[model samples]
Target: MAAKPNTVNPAQKKKQRAFEGVCKSLIPFARAAAVIASVALLLFLTPFVGIYNKDIPGMEITVGGFSAALCALSGQFTNVGAAFGNMDIFNHFAPAHCKVLAACAAAAALCLLAALVLCVVLAIGKAPGLHSAAAVLQALAFAALIVSFAFALAMSGTRLLPEYCSGNPACSVRSLAILPALAACAGCAVNFAAALRYRKAKKNI
Candidate 1:
C-alpha cells in the first residue's frame, strides 16, 4: 500500500508565515533604533552644558561643572580655562569628582556601543537568543545613562564650590548640559521598546 501524504494545516501555516514576516520587519527597525540611541548617548557625553560667565556671553566659565563628558580625565578643563580666562579657577578643585563622573559616562558609552553591536548582529542573524540578549544590553545601557545623569545633577547642586562664584557672580551652571542626556535617555527608551517588540514577535513564532 502507498504511504499517505503528509497534511498541512492552511490556517496554522498562514499564521506562522505572518509571524515570520513580522519578525523580519521588526529586526531592522530595532537595529536602527539601537544605533540612533547609541549616537545620542555619545553626543550626550560632550560638554554642551556647564557654568558660563555672565560678563562674557560666549565664554564658558568652569566648563563641565555638571557632567564628565568633556572635563573628566581628558584635561579638557585646561583648554576650557585657557579659552575663558577665569573658568579654570573653579573647575580645578573638582578634578577628582569629575574623574568619577567621567568613568560613569565612559561605562555608559561602552554599554551603549556593545548594545548597538549586538543589535546589528541580531538584525543579521535573527537568532532568538540574540533578541533577548540585545534587549538586556539596551536595558543595561539605559540604566547606566540614567545613573550618570543622576550623579551629574547631584554634583551640580552639591559639589559646585561657592568660592568659584564669590568674586564673579556671573558664573552659573547651564541647564542645557542635561538636555543631551535627556535626549539619550529618550533614544535608549525607544531602542529598548523596539527590542521588546522584536522579542515578542519572535516568541509568537
Candidate 2:
C-alpha cells in the first residue's frame, strides 16, 4: 500500500497563522530595541566626570554614573570635603549641578532597562499590546540621557565644569576630552535617525 501524506489539522493551521502574525507585528519593536540598546550603552560610556585642573592632560577625576549618583544622593562625599554641585573657581560661583545630572543618568538607566525588557517580550513573546509602553519608555530614557549631556555642556565654559578647573591658563576644554564628546555626538545623531525611522514605520502599522 502507498503511504498517505501527513497533513496539518485546521486548528494547527490557525495557530501557526496567529503566531506568524504576532511575529510580524513585532518587527518594529525589535528594531527600536536594538537602537535603544546602542544609545543607552553609548551614553553610559561617558564618564560621571569632574576634575581639579583642565590644563594637565589625563588628570580629570572621573567616576562611574552609578557611583556618582549614589555618592551625591547619600551625601557621602560631602564629609570628604567634596561639596558636589557647589564650587567656586576663577572668581565665579559655578553651580555644576553634577549631583542632579548623576541622578538623571541613573534614572535613565532604569528606564532603558525596563524598555529593553518590554521590547524583548513584545518581540519574542505574544505581548504586542505592550509596544506603545515600551517605545515611550525608550523615548524617555533617550530624553533623560540627552538632558544629562546638555547639562554637562551648557554654560560650563567648557566640556565639563571649566570653572572648577584651575591651573596656569587652563583652557575651556582638553584635547583628550574632545574625543569622547565627539563620539557621543555621533552616537546621538545615530540615535536620532533611528528614532525618526521608527516613528515613520509606526505610522504604517
Candidate 3:
C-alpha cells in the first residue's frame, strides 16, 4: 500500500492569505496619517509671529502632536502640563494666552516626540515576528485629536488668538489670524476623515 499522501488545506491557506493582506494594508495608512500628522504638528513650531499667528496653526500642531504622542505611548495620555513652566519661550507672551499656549505647546511637544516613536514602531512592525497594536491605536489617537482640536478651536474663537491681545479686551482682534485658523480648519477635516476610516477598519477587524 502507498503511504498516505500529505494534504494541504485550501480554506486555511485562503484565510492566511487574507490575514496577510489585512496586516499589510493596516499600518501603511496609519503610518502615513501619523507622518502627516507629525509634520503638521511640528510645523506649528515655526516662529508664530507677525502675519502667521493664529490658534488654528497652533491647533494643528497641538492636534498632530497629540495623535503622535498617543502612538508613542502605546495609546496612553500622559500629563506633562507643568513642564511648560520650565520653558523660557512661554515667558514672551500675554500672561493669560501665554500660559494657555505654553501648556498647549508642552503637550504638543510630547505628542510629536511620541509620533517619532510611532514612526519607528511602524517601520519595524513589517518584519517577521513583530506584534504591534499601534496600527489600531493610530486611528483612535488621531480621532481624539480631531475632536479635541475642533473643541479647542471653537473655544478659542470666543477666547482669543494670542496675537489679538493687547493686555486688555479693548484691543482689536487681528484680521490676519483668521487665515491660519481657516487653514487649521482644513487640517481638522482631514484628521476627522482619517479617524473615521481608522475606526471603520478597526470595526471590520
Off by over 4 Å in 1: 1-12, 59-92, 123-125, 128-132, 156-160, 175-177
**Model 3: lDDT to the true structure:** 0.39
All candidates: TM-score: 0.66, 0.56, 0.43
What is the C-alpha local distance difference test score of each model? 0.55, 0.50, 0.39
Backbone clash pairs in model 1 (N, Cα, C under 3 Å; residues 3+ apart or in different chains), count: 1
Writing each residue's lDDT as its tens digit, candidate 2 over 1-205 gives 9989998788777766765564565565465564655555455544544443545765345444545445546645443334332212211332355555556666666766676666566555545555556656656665665665565444355424433444335534211222323333443343344445445544444
Q: What would the TM-score be for candidate 1 when compared with the true structure? A: 0.66
Of the candidates shown, which would achieve the greatest TM-score relative to the real structure? 1
151 Cα displacement, candidate 3 (Å): 12
Candidate 3 is scored at a TM of 0.43
Per-residue lDDT of candidate 1, residues 1-205 (tens digit): 9999999888778878977776677666666756665665556534533566768766454333224444444556455444333325434655554555555555656666676776677667465345555556556655655555555445445446365555456665553335445544555565566657666766765
Q: How many backbone clashes does candidate 2 have?
A: 0
Cα lDDT of model 3 by residue, 73-188, tens digit: 43223334432211222223223433343344345444444544654464444531121233333333344434433433343444343443533433322212223233333433
Model 3 pairs in collision: none
